[model samples]
Target: MDLIDFSAIATEHATRLKAIDPLLPPPGELPDDQGVLTAEASGSAALGVLSCEKTPADAPGAQWRALVEHRLDLRLAGPDPGTALGLLLEKWQERLAESGTERGDWETAAVVIRPSRDSTGSGELLRHGFAPVRVVAVRPAERHGRGPRRTPGVAVRTATRKDVGNVVELLLELQHYDAQFGVATVRESTERALTAEVEEVLAKDEPLLWIAEVYGKALGVARVQLPPASDWSKIYVDQSGRPKLGYLTSLNVAEQARGTGVGTALAEHAHQVFDTEGVDLALLHHALANPRSTPFWYAQGYRPLWTYWYRRPAVR
Candidate 1:
């Protein structure tokens, strides 16, 4: 609020941004046009920092970083005697001050920051002092065509529960290539997640675990993850105090199904369904390291939403 606080706020924002930048969105041309930007970073640093006695989270790394994805909205207000682009430098010092006070608190962090461009309200406050609070989800723009997928008959549908096993196997296959995109969710035979993952998928009315039939046999599997309702709920609130959309989470298709339109079909179909269900936004995360996933989503009309970053304070 004062001259002293911008550094603190900016520090927090930058710290939060850097910490979460790796896991959230790919940083490209900042989304100044649509009022959004995205960056990515590993959640590992955030994981170590957020490990505290309070703010009890069970699956600490996954759950806590996910919170950053949807719930990272922070704002700092201070004096803004606007010039050209340099107004931001003053804001950083103030923000840094504020964050310094809370250094030992709860492993606190933020990422995938969203900012608003309220240009209609013309004034110094609107122009000078008005730095946006960080928000979580900034989705891609309207997309009719995205990644390529298997053609219609190329993808066969699963007929029965017996098909689920083969589908799960194919899913495991894709996970090997997932590391190309910075995901390290490799299944351990020592720590078998197959049974648990399968059960969770089957329980969903919108089961992400799907079998793609080829040559009269199930050769591939793909799945979609619906982000928790809360992920969208925080962003979907209206002036009238009502929530609008539910969010989309992770989606994966088997290697065999890759160029045949399986991923593209699933994504397009999901988009149509979301539109029909009155959900206005569809969001997802992909690896920056993977050239295909990022370009693939970009082709689908998803624009840069926000950027996240990650690094340990010790490392910095």
Candidate 2:
């Protein structure tokens, strides 16, 4: 159908969704040139699904070798949009099968949706072979003017260019650990890519890098972006112009220091900083299956906002 009709369906969906969860961000405007598949079930308000693909090169971590992603942006409307969702997924699955995959063996089909919609569409997602892999979690900025809790001997400080080597080492440690859960991959160029990104952040006039140290030894890191710096992430978790957003880019604690409160201290420090800077909300993405991080973040007051469902290899 035309873009006008598609947008109307999406608008209707958004109207109903707000009543369900006011924090859920409105979907971004549909791309002018992308084609959308529409499904109209017997008693539904019609569902529109936009198909988009991302080559590894489109993102920094592309050099990681084993990552290819295909996405479906669903505009789900009506009282029972799940039925239409099932139909659209079925057709999309067929489209993938007929395309004949020469896309190597490292591809995944993904869909990201609000966590509140789980009951409505999750069953259909699972039936179509998709499983939750990652989540975009959120936290509000609130500490009642109190400072971050202190970890006995640990000190948190801003990182500078001189600390590049240590920062990269700690981040690499994080990537390798996440790789075990298939959330990340370590490739020949991984270090090179990471170094460039880390250096760029450190070079920023107001770099949001923090290092946790205990007696002159660095044991943890928290990378964050505040205000204008975090604007880019709005495409992932748009707050509908309601609040200023802050992003927790990455947080890593040395394996040896995992349970020693270093990570908590780092997180609280970041939250305090965000609150001080007047950031209204904080967002981050983490692996759903990570035994350690999943629980750690929940304890830090972040809960899942968007769940990314995936079917790996992207083949029928």
Q: What lDDT score is found at residue 171 in candidate 2? A: 90
Clashes of each: 50, 0
Q: How many backbone clashes does candidate 2 have?
A: 0
lDDT score for residue 66 of model 1: 22
lDDT winner? 2
Error of 1 at 116 (Å): 12
Score every model by TM-score. Answer: 0.53, 0.86
For model 1, what is the C-alpha lDDT against the true structure?
Answer: 0.40
Q: Candidate 2, which ten residues in sequence have the lowest lDDT sum?
A: 142-151
The lDDT for every candidate, in the order shown, is: 0.40, 0.75
Score residue 81 of candidate 2 by CA lDDT. 74
> Could you say which candidate leads in TM-score?
2
